[model samples]
Target: MTLAVTGGAGFIGSNFILYMREKYPDLRIISIDCLTYASNRFVIDKLSCDANFRFSKTDICDRNEIYRLFEEEKPDILVNFAAESHVDRSIDGSEQFLRTNVLGTGVLLDACLRYGIKRFHQISTDEVYGDLPLEGDDPPFTESSPLNPGNPYSASKAAADLLVLSYSRTHGLPITVSRSVNNYGPLQHGEKFIPTVINSVLRGKNIPVYGNGKNVRGWLYVRDHCAAVDLILKNGREGEIYNVGATDYLQNIELAELICDRMRASRDLITFVSDRPGHDRRYDIDCTRLKTDTGWSPETAFSAGIEKTIEYYK
Candidate 1:
């Protein structure tokens, strides 16, 4: 089977590609990435040495290149991980996010239609459900939750999800979506929350916290997320949206403190910063549907995951 993984040079995408390769030694895996700033060329370079793996530095928004590659490779499955995912960058300018996340997804869908892919999996985030109150019994977002994107980044992703579903309904495409919470592990971009904390501790620099640092977010180990996606690809029902998440969650301040303690650094390293506009107070998600459907559950505890992440950065 030929599998095309977009944004395969990025953090999560690279990890997923490595997971797939290890599990399916004979499978032909193609890493498709546009080599954005967040991309890891070292990972791509290492994977390219594998006989069953191929790399394409191609953008998903480029219809011609995507179509050409689709026609030539005729991939059996295409998993989209491509997007301008940074919320801060999205707030600064939404046009690039729209072009890459929305229009790029459309272009991929068109290619999937023309080239006839067996399955098209979309990698999405729980942020699409917007924010919950910092404290309350508010129910976590389910697969049926209405999309209420709080930022341009999530809005773009939500739009892509809707577009994918529309194609499935209108054109009979086999597609599935997974909305997951924050993922942390090896190869994460330095600008991301966890990595920033680790890097700050290692460099003896202050760890910046947004607002009063009360925002809550669920955390999932990247490998667990990759495993869930693999299961969805193998056994997930078509035209279904699955919520993949773990119970591990922490407020921004708490998370920073935990990392400092774990690293044996001073808590004084943490500094509060002004919050971004429309910052979500919290994000919670329910993965009961995914567990019921595929018997998938998170394996790594937050403590273990954080330790591994810190070691990687060290």
Candidate 2:
């Protein structure tokens, strides 16, 4: 089977490609990435020697380029991971997020319809459900939850999710959307929280925290996320949305403190700052559907994952 994965050079995409290549050695894989700032080719450089792997530098927003890739590759499975995913950056500039997350998704769905692809997987985020009332003991966001995207980045992702569902309903497209929570592991860029904390502590710099840093997020190890995606792609029901998470919840400040403790850095380096506009107070995902259907659960403990991630940066 030939799989086309967009944004294959980005953090999650690169890790997914590596996982897929190792697990399914005979499967042909074509990765298309625009090599944006967060993209790193070095991650997949070793896979160049594998006959089953191919990489193309292309933008998903360009209709002609996307069409050409579809025609040339004729992928059996299409996974759209291309997006401008940073929340802070999205607050500063939303145009790229809208273009890539919303319009790019539309273009890919159109191409899927034109090409008769078997399965289309849309990688979404828990941020689409926005912040839950931190005051109450409410359950996490589930597939049936209403979307209340707080930031432009999440709004764009929510728009893309709706687009995929529209295509599936109207055009009879075989699509599955997986909404995952905060992912932290190796190869992540320095802008993200975990990496930022680790890098800053190593450099003896203050670890910046937004607000009081009490915002809660469910953390999922990147490899476990890849495993869940693999299961969803193969056995997931069409037009169904699955939430993937490890059920590991931690406050932003708590996470930073854990990193500091692990790295032998003083908590004095922690500095609170003004929160970004539209910052969601907390994000949590209910992975019950995924767990019940696929029997998929995260195997990595938070401490272990953080240690491994920190070591990778070192």
Query: Candidate 1's residue-wise lDDT over 1-314, tens digit each?
Result: 99999999999999999899889989999889999998998667887578888899899999999999998899999999998989999999999999999999999999999989999999999999999998789998999989999999999999999999999999999999999999999998999999999999999999999999999999999999999999999989999999988658899999999999999999999999999899999998989889988989889988898999999999
Q: What is the C-alpha lDDT of each candidate?
A: 0.94, 0.91
Per-residue CA lDDT of model 2 for 46-144, tens digit only, reads 787888888999999999999998999899999888899899999898999999999999999999999889999999999999998667888888999
For model 1, what is the error of residue 64's alpha carbon versus the real structure, in angstroms, after optimal superposition?
A: 0.8
Model 1: how far residue 295 lies from native, Å? 1.0
Clash pairs detected, candidate 1: none
Q: What TM-score, to 2 decimals, does candidate 2 have?
A: 0.98
TM-score of each: 0.99, 0.98
TM-score, cand. 1? 0.99
- Cα lDDT over the full model 1: 0.94
